[model samples]
Target: MTPQQEPPPFLGTWARVYWGVVLYLAAVIGVLMLFTASFRL
Candidate 1:
């Protein structure tokens, strides 16, 4: 048997790694902002 390598399941390419990282950061930032606003009250 031989080994095989595959890219991201959804993105289908290595570029998805960078995209995923950026999207994750954006999501985290958005969540933090919401928390900050809620606490400011």
Candidate 2:
């Protein structure tokens, strides 16, 4: 099999990776909302 079958180095598990992505997306959305509110957009 290819290296894709192995787990990530830092996070280790795919579940953690998924959660990390979710958190990142949430953070980005939160920042955009704050920016929009500040600009009254």
Candidate 3:
């Protein structure tokens, strides 16, 4: 027998939510790097 799992509230499923978090972090880091470079120039 298999256990039934519930989907997350936003983003459809848990996996999508995880990927969304990853992408958000990457975007934040990219923006931070851009700011750092602009300030250093």
Candidate 4:
């Protein structure tokens, strides 16, 4: 027997939530890289 699971609160599905988190992490990394590059001499 299998147990029922609940959907993510925001994105509705687990896959979408995972993708959203990935995209958010990528964006944050990109911004941080840019910030670091600008400060480099």
Q: Who wins the TM-score comparison?
A: 4
Segments of candidate 1 deviating more than 4 angstroms: 1-12
- Looking at candidate 3, the ten consecutive residues that score lowest on lDDT are 1-10
Tell me each candidate's TM-score: 0.61, 0.75, 0.77, 0.78
For model 1 the local lDDT of residue 32 reads 94
CA RMSD (A), model 3: 2.9
Candidate ranking (TM-score, best to worst): 4, 3, 2, 1
- Cα deviation in Å at residue 21, candidate 2? 0.2
User: What does candidate 4's lDDT look like per residue over 1-30, in tens digits?
Assistant: 333577767988889999999999999999
Spell out the clash pairs found in candidate 3: none
CA RMSD per model (angstroms): 3.1, 2.3, 2.9, 2.6
Candidate 2, position 5, lDDT: 80
Off by over 4 Å in 3: 1-4
lDDT of 2: 0.91
lDDT (CA) per prediction = 0.81, 0.91, 0.89, 0.89
User: Is candidate 1 or 3 superior in TM-score?
Assistant: 3
Deviation (Å) of 28 in candidate 1: 0.4
C-alpha displacement of 33 in model 4, angstroms? 0.2
| Candidates, ranked, lDDT | 2, 4, 3, 1
